[model samples]
Target: MLRMEILKLIRNNVVALIIAYILAMSIGINILSFGFDELAWVERWLPILTIFYVVILIDLLFWMAAMQISEDMETNMIQVMRTSRNVIQYFFSKHVLLLLFILVAAFLGIIPMADQFGFVLNFLYVTLVFSVVMIASGVLLAMIVKKQSVVMLAGSVVTGFIFAVMVRLVFPLWNISPIPFNPFEAFIKAYYYLYLPVEPPNQSYVALTLIAVLFYIISLYVFKKLTFDRGFRL
Candidate 1:
């Protein structure tokens, strides 16, 4: 079933789309930063990378979740699949596929800057954690809405609102010197600290991990509710 799901993603051109988007963005960012001092370029582009990573990557997850869920519901395949397999395991397989997509995308996106930035593991770690949260959220949204168009619309609005709130309000309020409170702000600070000599506090890592876990737990609850209570209704 997992193999079938992966093959379906490829057949639908979803894999190609994700690869193309990540490569395009990475190439574009690399080209744009070409004449600048290497360190300066990384410094300037880090925020852009963060923004792009958050918005586009999350949007891709939303698109995939909506499409996959809608197709299953429309074709009534989910019902059939659930009868034969553990529904939770089936849902988790979707997550596994999404995580694979994220890993490929992140590698493509980060490779261009690796030589210049010296391969920041923190960037990859944070992105993977963020991807988990986003993937779970996307699946939850798809399960609740059960309509591709509505899922896309609502996902965009919700992500946009999150970006706005984090950048404009949350980050500013919590991005204190030496001890940042918000995970997004910590991400930014951690990125800078990678290049600069300053060491990021351990609390940032702990906090982000905890938040991701919380989001994953909530998403699972929503998934269970949809599977059992709602019967995965469309």
Candidate 2:
């Protein structure tokens, strides 16, 4: 079932196009930067990782969920599957596929710079947590909005807004202050607090992890409840 789900994504033209675009952009940037200064590759890795984390990762998960679930619901394929398989199996399959996609993309994006970064465990942990949060949010949004187009638009806007706010908080100017009680800001802060030189309160780590888990649990419950019926409204 997981194999089939992955194949379905492979056959999607939009997915293929997006993947190609990412690869081309990554390669092009690496080539252009390498020509200017061979020793400055390490400096390039941070921006690449940041772009992948803030935009590519979220966009990929959102579109994949929208395509896999929304399209299946639209065609009534989910209804057929539900007759034979439990909702948990279906949901788990989707989650597994999503994780696989994220892992593959992250591997591709990070491996080139891994030597320079020197295998940071904090980076890996933060990436895993961020992937879970984004995947859960994508699945939840896909369940709520059955239309792929709307999901794509809504996800882009929401992810962009969150990314912008978080980026501001991370690289704040002298006079700027991040919004108080911003969960996204806290999440990014916790990430940097763990890996970077900054020393945030220890509670930041606990709070971020708890928030990620909470979102995952909520997504799971919503998915199960919705799939219990006709498998999300079309």
Candidate 3:
């Protein structure tokens, strides 16, 4: 199942899009980063890199997740395969695929910034947890939504809300010591302490890590219950 999925990924435009996404982000963001005065001197580039552009990646990831499952549901492939194989394992293969995709994409995406910051393990750690949350969120959205287009839209909306909340964009005046469960927002601290000698409190990491686990459990439960009959669409 996993091998077949890998073949599908390689044969499709998803791989190309990931490369494009990373390249566009790396170059376009450098231009955008300069619009703000003293972006590097003030250490503000990381936040802009993370919050400003991540929605595009989120949309791509959600679309990938939805396309993987929704296309199967839209056709008879899943139905035909269910007779011989565990369909749940088939879906799980997609989950693993998305995990690997994000890790690689994120690791490569950091290359431009790595010249100054070098490679930071915490960046990968934050990305690892973020990918887990994103995969789980994408899977859960796939389970609930039956159409590729519809699921993509809905997943973006759901993830956008979560992203807003996590970074305190929803309530800047909340005056909270620690923010809500968020992974993408950790991009700054993940590098600062290691590269710039600026120590981080790490309060957000602890909180976001907890939610990442909870989201995974919930996604697996819903994914296990996923069924074609339950999402029958003409």
How high a TM-score does candidate 1 get? 0.73
- Segments in model 2 whose C-alpha atoms lie over 4 Å from true places: 28-45, 48-55, 78-80, 116-118, 169-171, 174-182, 190-195, 198-206, 230-234
Whole-model lDDT per candidate? 0.63, 0.63, 0.61
Q: Clashing pairs in model 2?
A: none
Higher-TM-score candidate among 1 and 3? 1
| Alpha-carbon lDDT of model 2 | 0.63
Count clashes in each candidate, considering only residues at least 3 apart in sequence or on different chains: 0, 0, 0
How does candidate 3 fare on TM-score?
A: 0.67
User: Which is the leading candidate under TM-score?
Assistant: 2
- Rank order (by TM-score, best first): 2, 1, 3
Task: Tally clashing residue pairs in candidate 1.
Answer: 0
Model 3 Cα RMSD, 1 decimal: 5.3
Q: 2 or 3, which is superior by TM-score?
A: 2
Candidate 3 lDDT by residue in tens digits, 7-108: 878776766877677778766655554454455643555544553354446447666877777777776664546542554556677777877777666655
Distance from true location, Cα of 210 in model 2, Å: 3.0
Per-residue lDDT tens digits for candidate 2, residues 1-234, read 777677777888887877776677566555554554355754635544444453456456656765677777777675547553666676677777776666656555444446756444445556567667877777778777777778777776656656666657545574456555544555555545534555555555456678888888888787777754554543
User: TM-score for each prediction?
Assistant: 0.73, 0.77, 0.67
